[model samples]
Each structure stands twice: as structure tokens, then as C-alpha cells.
Target: MFSNAVKCRQIHLIATSIAHYWPLLHERPLSTLTTTAISQEPSMFVTSSIFIILYCGLSLMLCWCDYQSGLLPDRFTCPLLWVGLLYHLYLSESTLSSAVWGAIAGYVSFATIYWLYRGLRGYEGIGYGDVKFLAALGAWHGWSVLPQLVLIATILACVTLGIKIIAGRKRQVLYNPLPFGPFLAAAGLWCGWQTLISPPP
Candidate 1:
């Protein structure tokens, strides 16, 4: 009888415990629980994170190479352009037609500016490599954002030049060639991150 009573008491405690916790469990919406579960898991964002890292690594590498050598190698720029197309094609993040048009526009616009500047100044104001780099950026971001990207890069480059002139670091700003690739790379990376976080509608 004592043993039976003890078992009954344990059962009663278990029931009470369940009753106390049941409201807490039931009160949580399934969506809230699902969200919490998803938040705790990092694998869901692994692919996006990898892509972001790859984009950043490539952009930084190009930036460094341009700063050090004043050249943007076709090896890097071409691969970046192709990969961007492939990214959009396979990922379906954007239409392949858009990427192609972007690349065309990017190249033509910059090349036009390059030739016009040369015609007016009798010298090349921009390198061919910079043109290719901008094309690669367009491949990744599409033509929609190209204007903003160029504007940002131009603003950044102008600001840097202004600072250098103010600091008396560059006496002959026109004579001293400034590599535009780094500024373009920086702007591209910024736009890339923005695209990754919030894709275009």
C-alpha cells in the first residue's frame, strides 16, 4: 500500500509539472518556434555566406593588385565576369539577358569615355583594364545599378584626390596618375554586399 501511494504521488507530481509547462509551450506560436529554430541554425545561410566571402575576397584581391601594380589582370577580371554570369544563370537571381546587357553597356560606356578623353586630351585618361573591371562589376550587379556604382566610385576617387591635394601630398595631381581600379573595386564590393542582403525586386 505504501509503495502504491508513493507511485501515485510521483505520477501526481509529473502531471502537475506537465500542467505547469503546458501553457508556456502552447502559448508559443508555431511560427515563432520555427523562427527560433531557424535562427539557431547557421547552415541555412552557408551558401550565401560563402558567396559573399568569395565576392569580397576577389574584390579585395583586385583592389590590392591594382593599387600595387596599376594593372587589373584579365585573368582575374575575366573570371569575375564569367562567374557573375554563371551565378545569376544558375542561381536564377537575375536574368542572363540582363547580365549580358549590363556587361555590354558597362564596357561601351567606359570605353567611350576613355576614347573621348584621349581625343580631347591627346592622352589616355583611363586604362583598358579599368574598363574591363567595370564590365565585370556590371556582370555581377546588372545594368540597373551601374550608374550608382559609377557615381559612388567617382565620388570616392574625387574625394581621395581632393584630400591628397589638400594635404599637399600630390603637387601635380594631373601629372601623377591615379589608378581608378581600387576605387571601382571598393564601390563594387559595397554594391555587391547590398545586393546580397537585399536583392532587387
Candidate 2:
């Protein structure tokens, strides 16, 4: 079980790497980073589509890897994210650097939770892997996905916690070190879809 920071970090790295690889495998238009090969102009829908593809694919892979190996092998997510940064820079043709900020925001937010878990003695409450995984996820869509991600994570964590409490009927159940990466990844996917459908500011 992923009962430690190292395990959490490993999961994060794996999930991030999966997210980074998605665009490469998808054959996205190098120039537009959109859904179709059209004029150079960008459309939010196209961006959202690409993001969804990456998010979903990455989510499944990360979860599966966690289940089977119990190790999210760093050889994957970390370096792959750097590659994703370069890839996004080349494709989107924008100086805003969406990927870089997204990754940074994800790491900061997730890391904050990780530290909080440590401070509060809430191990098994969250993992370091959850943190890095968010880095890659945030790198995908940035802060826009964060609110929804938190909402989803909170909802799922509560539901699971309740179920866990019920399953054993123990007053002081030691929470198992389970994977939160997949849930957060799902939240990110749903959040990306929301961005696609919502009216722009």
C-alpha cells in the first residue's frame, strides 16, 4: 500500500508522465494544438478536447500502474513532464506558457496538502505522489481545473472515508494508504470538460 511520502511521490511522477505522453501519442496538430487542422487561430473547444484526451488516458494508466506495481516509477512522470513543457511550447505557439504555470500551481497546491498531512499526522490522508501528479495535471489545464479538482477530490475522499468507516465499524480505523491520484485525475478530466462548455469571462 502507498503508506508513505516516497510511494506518493512515485505515483505522482507516474501520473504526470502519462499526462505528458498523451499529446504525443494523439497526433495533435502541431501548429494549432486544436481538434482540427484549420487556420492558425485557436479555439477553446479544441484545446479542451486535447486536454480531455490527455487527462483520461493518463488517469487510467496511472491508476492501473499503481494497482499493479505499487510503485509509480519516477523514470516516467518527471522527465516526461519536462518533455511535455517543450512540446506545448512548440505547439501552442503562445508565450503565456500554460503548461509551466499549470505544473507549478499543481505542485504548490498538492505539496501544501502533503505538508499539511505530515504536520497534522494525517499520513494515509494524502501522499506526496498526489502532489507531483497534480503538477502534471495542473500543467495540463492550469488553475482552471483546480477548483473542480478539489471539489471532486473532497467529495470522493468523503464518500470513501464513510464507506471505509462503515466497512469495519471501528471507532479508530487506521486509514489505508490508498490511491487518490486516479480520483484527482478524474476531477481534472471533468474540470477540463467544464472549461470547454462554460462561457468565457
Candidate 3:
């Protein structure tokens, strides 16, 4: 009788333990849910992060070169242009038609301004490299970001020129040929980040 009573108590304890743990066992874990979310959209996050890093690094390199030599070489700009086109082709983030048009529009618009300014002033206002840089950016981010790039670059360039003018009387001349590459490159990177992080409607 005692053994039977003990068996009954043991069975009751087992049942109580299972009841206590049942809710936990059935519940979904936070970590599991997080993992599932990551799995669902892993490509977008991973590719975007990689592109950001690469784009920023490339911009920095261009800025440094321009700062040192007031020049933007074809070596860097050419690669940037090609890579952007290839990236879009492979990823389908944008149509090839859009990228081609963007590249053409970017180069032509800047070239038009450059030639017009040169015709009136008898000197080039912006370099060929600057035009190529814009073309590359447009190809990568599409024409949508071009306006933002131009606006940001213009504001930054104006601010920089203002500062140089203010400091010139007290100090040496800032630059004989002011380098617009850094400003353009910085603006392009910023606009690219903006587009990548929060795509337009």
C-alpha cells in the first residue's frame, strides 16, 4: 500500500513538472525569430553592407588623390564606372537601360556645363575627371540620385570656396587650382548611402 502511494506521488510530481514547463516548450524563442528574419532577407543586408564599405573606401581613395594632386585619374574613375555597370547587371537592382541612360546623362550634362563655362571664361571650370565621376555614380545609383548628388556637391563646394575666401587674407592662397573632386566624391558617397539605406518610392 505504501509503495503504491509513493508511485502515485511520483506520477503526480512528473505531471506537475511537465505542466510547469509546457508553456516554455511551446513558446518561440527570441533568438530563433531573429535568425529566421535574417535568413529571409540575408542577401539584401549582406550585399548592401559590402557595397557601402567598398563605395566609401573608393571615395576616400579618390578624395586623397585629388587632395594631393588636384587630379582625378582615369584609372580609378574607369574602374568605378565599369564596376557599377556590372553590379547592376548582376544584381538587377536597376535595369541596364536605366544605367546606360544615367551614365550618358551624367557625362553629357557636366560636359555641357564644362564647355559652356570654358567658352566664356577661356578656361575649364571643372575637370574631365569630375564628369566621369558623376557618370560612375549615376550608373551605380541610377539617375534618381543624380540631382541629390549635384545639390549636395554644389552646396559643399560653395561652402568650401567661401571658407577659402574668408581665410585667404590672413593665410597663403588655398589652392591655385581648387580641387572639386573631394567635394564631388564625398557627395556621391553620401547620396549612395542615402539611396541604399532608404530607397525612394
lDDT per residue for candidate 3 within 47-166, as digits (tens), equals 656666666777777788998998888888877777777766755644666777778888999999999999999989899888998888787777877888889989998887778789
Residue pair clashes in candidate 1: none
Model 2 has an lDDT value of 0.63
Which regions of candidate 3 are displaced past 4 Å?
1-44, 93-95, 169-175, 198-201
List the global CA lDDT of all models: 0.83, 0.63, 0.78
| Each candidate structure's count of clashing pairs | 0, 6, 0
Model 3, residue pairs in steric clash: none
For candidate 2, the TM-score is 0.59
Top candidate (lDDT): 1
TM-score for every candidate vs. truth? Answer: 0.73, 0.59, 0.71
Descending-lDDT candidate ranking: 1, 3, 2
lDDT of 1 at 128: 92
Judged by whole-model lDDT over C-alpha atoms, candidate 3 comes out at 0.78
